[model samples]
Target: MNVADDDDPPPIVVPEVTVTAGGAVTEGAGAVFTVAAEPAPDAPLSVNVTVGQDGDFGASTGSRTVTVGTGGTATLTVATVDDDADERDGSLSVTVDSGDGYTVSSGHASATVNVADDDDPPPIVVPEVSVADASIVEGEMGALSPLEFRVALSEASEQDVTVRYVIRSGTATDGLDYWGGTGQVTIGAGRTSGLIGMNVKDDILWEGDETLTVELTDADGAVIADGRATGTIIDDDD
Candidate 1:
């Protein structure tokens, strides 16, 4: 019988295996598996790798296989289909089987794919304006009363309106500056009635017959409407 030395131990064998995580990928983006391994100096070693879907990977499966030679790495790209509109979160695994000489050291990794959308609209345009009103008084100090008039709007609009009034006096030949006021008004959609009032100042009262013109304008200073009225002011001395 041959006697074996008690101190002799079997040579330690380190199995050659491959490990890797799929490259950068988006929620909806596709990816493949890769292998890292050790190869013999001259003898070629073959490695087979498989990829499997895991976690939020929902209903999708990958079973692709690839072969790698000694001192070489193999990449097995698994075709992937993404049906998600939003970003998807999940994990995948890779298994490497090296015939006999190696054991898989690292055969698992994680993957992610992203998805997105882009489109939107403009704001609503509103209507706006300016207005002018004029009047003549027939009284002395403290005797004039307020006068009112209606300026008809051409079209009915829901937009908030601003009116500017320029009251002018005199004939069609000579223009005279008179009193006026500015204000804001809202016309309900399709409603047309608008009223403007002015207080006749005793100091600005005109004696005898007079003619006045009122100009109505929009917010942009564009003339939208106008009116002319004649009034007779009685002289206090008469």
Candidate 2:
């Protein structure tokens, strides 16, 4: 009756399986993966895979199981996606799923970005103004050229100012009268000095003191500063 079975129980049959995983990923980011498996020749098989944090796995082939032929190999490609938003500072991570007879390996990469402010204020300075060589002699005939004096200004400004010079003969029966021309001068901002000249003519030569007055005016024509110079016109007979 079936004479005691022998020969290692007719060589027990076993199934062979293989799995491979791969995909793109980022550090501190999320990703998805797909897994595939191959079964031993003429044997039934199944594949199960797991994903790491921020990781996902899915199958693309119609089925997760693959039938293998005699002495043949099976292959499967996994798809992964990263959705992490916190890694904006610049870091990346990639992960893979290991199932069946497969090995898993992970890697990371990174980049950097910077931000800054670019606004600043301009420097400040004080405004100043003054006159140089403020005095001049009278009737001396070029003894004191009015053009030699000047007005100085510091820093730019829109303020309007004028310089004027006048000469009046001493109180005499024959007071001298002459066209001194325009005695007005304008001072430009940031300018070291501005020049002004004067001309005088005498109808009668006198032997008394003559007065030369220099005045500075504001935009409203109001006197702001005044200087005077005096000298005597000697008679030629002396």
Candidate 3:
């Protein structure tokens, strides 16, 4: 009983790993993928590749091993990490990882690369607030002189530049000749200039040179440019 019958062994074709993605990549610049394999796998296949990213983009994931010979196609380079922040612009994925010979195509497995966002967003200052004009000398008889008014800032603001003053009455006379009313002046954080003090009340009678008007009126980050200033009250009783 030995009827020679031996000849039946030729059916082992497992190759269906697809993933192709390349275009739009600027963060450190790197994205090129193609790990195909459809019907060309007679002896060199390997396969196992993964690279991912989807948001905030730092880009660069792992998983390697891609041969795909028999002239099927194989090239995968994915790297992108140029983060300084200013985020927004992400998308990068190329996967075909199953293992052993390959077979993972549900519709091209997975592929997408479009990360673009070079990083740029920082610029917006807004600073300009001025008010200067002064002269003070009115003392004798309960004297209280102090009159200083010079609040400027054309540029030099990282932040903190609040100015909103008011002391109207060009002929002097706020609480009865002078006493700076309603105020707010910060100007600090790189600073440009700041000084606003007013207190002059010397009653002896000789009211000769009198004037008072300091108005800046509202300013947060700053932008009131040369509001208004004039304080002079020099009448040394003579």
Who wins the lDDT comparison?
Answer: 3
Candidate 1, residue 83: the lDDT equals 50
Stretches off by above 4 angstroms in model 2 are 1-126, 132-148, 154-183, 187-190, 202-204, 219-237
Summarize candidate 1's per-residue lDDT along 93-120 as a digit string, tens digits: 6666545555666434333322221112
Q: What is the C-alpha local distance difference test score of candidate 2?
A: 0.36
Clashing pairs in 2: 25-93, 26-92, 26-93, 27-92, 27-93, 30-82, 31-81, 32-80, 32-81, 33-56
Best by TM-score: 3
Ranked candidates (TM-score, high to low): 3, 1, 2
Query: Candidate 2 on 120-214: residue-level lDDT in tens?
Result: 33444334544444333343464323324455555445555455654433332223422243366666543445665554444344444344333
Candidate 3: the clashing residue pairs are none
Across 1-238, the per-residue lDDT of candidate 3 in tens digits comes to 8798698888887888898898878877888888889888877889887777887665657777879888888888777878788878888887887988678999888899888888788778788888899888888335787888889898899878889898888888888778777888898989899998878888778779999888889988988978998888888887
